[model samples]
Target chain A: MDFQTILILAQDAITNSAIYALLALALILVFGVTRVIFVAQGEFVSYGALTLASLQTGVMPGTVWLLLILAFIAACMETARLLVSGARHKLPGALATILAPPLAIAALVKICTPLHLHLGWQLILTMLIVIPLGPLIYRVAFRPLADATVLVLLIAAVAVHFVLVGLGLLFFGAEGVRTPPFSDAQFTFANLNVSGQSLCVYATTIVFVAIMAWFFNKTLYGKALRAVAFNRNGARLVGITPHLAGTFSFALASAIGCLSGLLIGPITTLYYDSGFLIGLKGFVGAIVGGMASYPIAAAGALMVGFSESFSSFWLSGYKDVVVFTMIIPVLLWRSLTTAHYEEEE
Target chain B: MKQFLASISMLAVLAAGTAAQADITIGVNLSSTGPAASLGIAEKNAISFGPSVIAGQKVHYVIYDDATDTTTAVQNVKRLVSENKVDVLIGPTTSPTSAAVIEAVAASKTPMIQLSPGPATISATDEKRKWIFSAPANTTIYGTAMINHMVKKGVKTVSVIAVDDAYGEVSTAAYKTLSEPKGIKTLTIEKYKRTDTSATAQVLHAMQGNPDAIFIASSGTPAALPHVALIERGYKGKIYQSGGAANAEFLRVGGKALEGSFMLAPPVVVGEQLPDGYPTKAEALKFIKAYEAKFGPRSMFASLAWDALKIVEAAVPKALKKGKPGSEKFRVALRDAIEGTKGLKGAGSVFSMSATDHSGVNQLGMSLMKVENGKWKLEDHAEFK
Candidate 1:
C-alpha cells in the first residue's frame, strides 16, 4: 500500500518476471517450431540447477547417466528404423551421431566432476550434461510421433514430463537445493535495495531477449524454423526439414530452460518438482501472447509475475488461483480479436 | 504318490502355523520418492536399524513407498493390512499420508504409530483415532517453546508466515494460543505454498505490522524461502522457525541469513550439546553416535523413526502376552499398550500417550536452539506451561 512496500514488491516482481520471461520465450519457441507443447521443458530447469549442485559438491551427477540412457534409446530407435528401411550403409553413422555425444559428455563429467573446478566450469558442465536431453527426447519420444496430431504430441509431452520428474526425483533426491550466489553485492539505489544477483538476472534476461529477437528475425536457421511453424509440409517442400527444425528448436528451448534454472537456482530453493509450477506459469504467459509472438510472450510473463507478486500480498493463499485465472479473459479476448481459419493439419 | 502328497501337506500346515506364531509383521508406509521424500528417506534409514527381534518373536517389516500421496498411502495401508496381515503399522511419514489412512487402520483394527510432526495428525475427539498413536513431539509443544523464548527476549508483537497446509494451520493457531496469554499480540498471518518460489509480497505484508518477531510455520526446506526473504528485506526483528523446519537442509538453504534465527527442536538436534540430566540426553547421545557413525550425518527427522522403535521396544512385550502375533486380539492389545505408554524416553523425546492424549510429549522433550555458525546450539533454557 505504501511506497516502500510497493517498491519491494516491484523489485520482487521484476526478479521473478525475468525467470518467467525467459521460460515464456522458450515455451513459445518450442510450441511454434516443434508443434509439440513441451511440457518437459521445465525439467531442464531443475536438471540444470541440481546438476550444478551435484558437481559443486564433487559428486557424479545423475544427469550424466540419464543422458547416456536417452542417447542409447535414441540410437536404438534410429537404428531400427534405418535397418527396417534397408539402409544398412547409414546405420553405423546414424548410431554414432546419436550415441557419441552423450558417451563423450559422460566421460568428460566422470573426469572433471571430482576436480572441484571453479563455478564457470561447473556451470558449463551442468549445461553439457542437461542440454542433450532436448534432442534426445525429440528423437526418442517425439520424433517417432512427429507426424502425429497435436493432441497425440501433447499427450506424449505430458508422459515425458512425468518420466522426467520421476527421473529428477531419483537423480537429485527430494530435498530442494540452493546454490551459492554468484555475487553477494548489495545495491542501494535511490529508493530500493537490489542484490547483484538480481541485477545479473535482469541483464541476462535482457541479453537473451535481444538474442531471441535477433535469432528469429535475422538468422537463417531462425527463418527456417519460422517457415516450418508457418506450414510444416510447405516448409518441407521448400527444403526445410520439419524434423530438423523441431530438433533445433528443442535444443534452443533446452538451453533457455537451463539458463533460467541457473539464474533462479541461487535466488530460491528448487526441488525436483518445483519446475512444474514455474513452467506452468510460463505456459500461462505464452497463452497470453496467443503462443505465437516472442516479445509479447516475454511481456505477458512479466505481467504474470507482477500480478502474482501483488495478489500474493492481498490474497496470498489464492495467489496461484488468481494468476491462473488471468488467462481466461485474455483467452476470451484472443478468440474475439483473432480470425478462425481452416486448419492445415 | 498319494502318501507323499499327504505328508507334504502336513509339513506345510505345521510350518505355516509356527511361522505365523513366531514372527510379527509390521507394515511401514512412507513417502520415499516424492515431495516428502526427505523425511521419508531419513525415517527409512533409521527404521531399518530397528530391533529385528522383539520379545522373542522375529519382527518383519513390510515397507512400501506411498510417494507422499494420499491415494497411494490409502492403497498401501489397505494392502498391508489385508495381504501382509501386519500386527501393527508404523508409518505414513507425513501428516497428509497419515491422516488419509486413519479409517483403513481403524477398520482393519491395526495399531498405527504415526511419525509425523503435527498434533492434528490424530484427534482424540475422533473415535477411530484411538487406533493411532503419534510418535513425534507435537508442533504446539514447539510453538510453546518458541513463545517462551520470545517472552524471554521481551518480544511483544509477532507476525506469522506459515505454509498453507494442516501443519501451518495447527502451528499458527498454537502460536496465537500461546502468545496471546503472554501479552504478545498477533499482528498478521500470511500463508504460501511449499513450492512457491517467491514470498516478497507476503514478507512485505507481514512487515506492515513491524512486529518484534516473525514465526515461520512451515515444514522442511520450504520454510527457508520466507525466512530468507524477510532477512533480505532488511527486517531487524527476530525470526523464529518451527521444529518441522529443523532439518539441516533448511539451514543449508537459508545459509548466512539463518545465522541468528531460533528454532524449537528435539534434544536430538544438538545431542552432543545437550546438558547433562536432560530428559532425552542419554538416548539422544546414543542415537547421535550410532546414527552419525553409520549414516555420516544425522537428520533429526530420523528420530521420529527411532522414537517409534523405542515405543515398540517398551510396549510390545506387554501386548505380546495378550495373544499370538497375527491375531486381531494382539493388534488391539498393542494399540492399548502403546496408548498407555508412560515416561518412556526415546531418541528425540519422552513419550507418554494416553487414551485421551495420543501425543503426550511435553516441554521437557523439546529444547530451544539457536543457529550459530551453521550448527544448532542448545540454549540455556527455561520451561513454559
Candidate 2:
C-alpha cells in the first residue's frame, strides 16, 4: 500500500483503460455511422497481439518497427481492395471481401506452425491480416444491410461474433497461449513508479483520440461523416455518399482495434476468448459514455479501468463485484438520462 | 410376400436379443472437445484402454461429448443409463460436471467410477453415497501433501496464486489452515480468472512481500512458466505448485526454468529408465514405445490416463460373472472388485485400493521429479503419511 506500489498499479490500470478506450471508440465509430455492431473486432486485436508474440519468439527475424510498418501497409492495401470491389455490387462482392481475412488468417496459422516462426510473429501476422480486413467487412457486410431492419443487422452482428469465435478456436485452440516476458522501463515522480509499457500504451491511445477528433472535425470527409451520423438522407441530398462514410467509419474503427490489440495483448497473453471479455467491457464503456459521445466513452473506459484497479486494492477477494457494481449504477443513470434526452428532443 | 415379411420379423427379433447378449455396453460421458478437451481426451482414452486390458470380455463403449459443462454431463449420463443401458459409467471429467451427474447416477442406483477431482459438491457424502466411488486423489491430498512438505522444510512465509474456481479455493483454504499452525505466514494471496494468464504483476506484488516462497495453484499452461518468470526478475526462492503442474507440459513450457524445481506427482507411473526384467515394466515400455510411435510425443497427462484405464481392465473379469452384463448386480460387483485390489502393478507403479481409500493412489507413491532438457527425470521419492 506504499505510494510506489500504488503508482505502478495505477499506471498499469490507466494504460489498460486507455487501450480499452481506443477499442471502444473504434466500436463507437462503427455504430455511429453504420447503425451496426461488429463483435469480431477482438479477432483483429488478437491479430496484433499474436503478431507481436510471434515476432518476439524469434519465429520472425523482423524488427518490431518493421513488423508494424509492413502490417499497416498490408492493411491499407487490403482496405483499398475491399472498398473498390464492394463499391458497385452488393451480394457476392461484399461476402467475398468480408470473409477474406478470417480465411487468410486461418491459412496463415496452419502454415506458420511448421515454419518455426515465433508464436508472437504468427500472432502479429494474423493481426496484420485481421485489423486491415475489418474495413472491407464493413464495406461489404454493413453497407448491403443498410436498408435492413435493426433486428436483422443485430442478428448479422451476432453471426459475425460466432464466425470469429469459431474460427479463433479452430485455428488457435482453446488454451491461452503463453507470452514471453518483456522488460518494463520505469517512470517515477516521488512516490510513483510507472512502467514504460503502461506509458506507451496510454500515450498511443491518447494519440488516436486526438487524431480521430481532428479527423471528424477538421477534414471535409469528417464533416460529411458527421452529417451522415446526424441525418443520412440530408447528407445524401447534399451530395455526400452516406454509405461510403459508413465504410470509412468502419475502417477507422478497425485500425483503432489493431492498436487496442497491441496495447492490451501482454496483459492476458493472446487468446481467442479475450475478445468476448474485452468486447463486453468496451461495450459497457460505450454505454456509459452516452453511446454516441467519443470523449465520454473514453472517460468512461478510464473510469471503469480505475475502479477495477482501486477495488482490487480493497476487495481483494471480490474485485469483480466492485467493478460490476459500479458499472450497473452508472449504466442505469445513463439509461435514465438518455430516456430524458429522447423525450426532450 | 406377406408370409416372407412375417418370417423376416421373427428373425430380426432373435438377432437383436443375441446381439444384446454378445456385448457389454460401457458408456463414456466425458467431453471430447472444447477448452477441457485435453482432460476429456485423457479420460476417454483411459476408459477405452481399460476394455482392451480386460482378459476375456467384449466391452463396447458408447461415447458422448459433455462439452465440459454440467448440464450437458447430466443429459449425457441419463442417455447412457436409460437409453444405452450401459452396465457401468466411468467418467464425467473435471469436478463441476461430475458433481452434476452424481445425483442422477446415484438415484438410478447405477454404479459409477467418478473420474474427477474434488471441491465439486458430491450429492451425498461418503457415508450416504455407496453406489458412487471416486477413483480418489481429491484436492485434500494435494493441499495436505504440500502443507506437510512446507512445514518439514521449515518454511515460515509464502504467497498463493490460485485459479478462481472451487478446486483452487479449496486447496488454498486447506494450505492456509495448515500453514498457520506451522507459522507459515501468507503475504498476499491472489485469485486469477481461469482464462487470465498475466501473472507478472501478481508475481511482483507477491515478491514485494519478500515471502519465503510462492505457491501457484493454477492448472493452466500459463502458470507452468512462473518459475522462469520469477527467476528472470531475480528472485531466488523455493517454488511449490499444486498437482496441476506435475505434468510434462509444464516442463516443456518452462524448459530450463523447471529444472531443479520440485513437483508432487502420483507415484512414478512411467518407468524411470528401463527397469530390470519385470513383466509390468516390459508391458509399460511396450505401451510407451507404441504410443510414441503413433502419437509422436505425448505429455504426462496421456500417461496418467493410460494407467487409470489399466485399473479398469483389472476389474472386468470378476465384475462380469453375472449372465447379463448390464445388470445392477454386475456393476456393484465390479465396484467391489475395483476397491478390493491391492499392490496392483501397472505402467505407473504399484497402486492399491480399498473402499475407504478412493484415489486408489496418493503422493507417497509420488516421487519428486525435475525437468532436464524439458523431460522430467526422477529426483526423490518419499513415503506418505
Per-candidate TM-scores read 0.93, 0.80
Query: How far off is residue A89 in model 2, in Å?
Result: 9.0
Real contacts retained, model 2: 0.24
* Model 2: per-residue Cα lDDT at residue B270: 41
Candidate 2 accuracy as lDDT: 0.65
For candidate 1, write residues B1-385 as lDDT tens digits: 9999999999999998898776989898888877777788888888878898997888999999998999999999999999999988889888888889998999999988888755665766677887888887786788778887888889998889999997788888888888888999888899999888899899999998689999899978899999999988888999888877787778888899998888888878888887678778899889888888888788887888888888877888999899888899888888889888998988788788877888878777788888999988888444422
What would the per-residue lDDT of candidate 1 be over residues A55-135, giving only the tens digit for each residue?
988999898888998898888888789989999999989899888889999999999988999998888998998888898
Q: Write model 2 residue lDDT over B1-385, tens digit each, in one string.
A: 9999999998999988776765677777777677778777765654544553245557788889998888889999999989998877777777778778877887666666666656343323364355565554666666666777777777788978777787678878878877787778898887666543234446566777688778877675656544554664556777876767665545545656665565655443445443355434555565567566656554344555565566667777777675457777776777677777677665544557766665555554344455566666655444522
Candidate with top DockQ is: 1
What DockQ results do all the predictions give, each relative to the true complex?
Answer: 0.65, 0.28
- Of candidate 2 chain A, the 10-residue stretch with the lowest lDDT total is A61-70
Error of 1 at B119 (Å): 4.0
Rate residue B312 of model 2 by lDDT. Answer: 65
Report how far residue B277 has shifted in candidate 1, in Å. 1.4
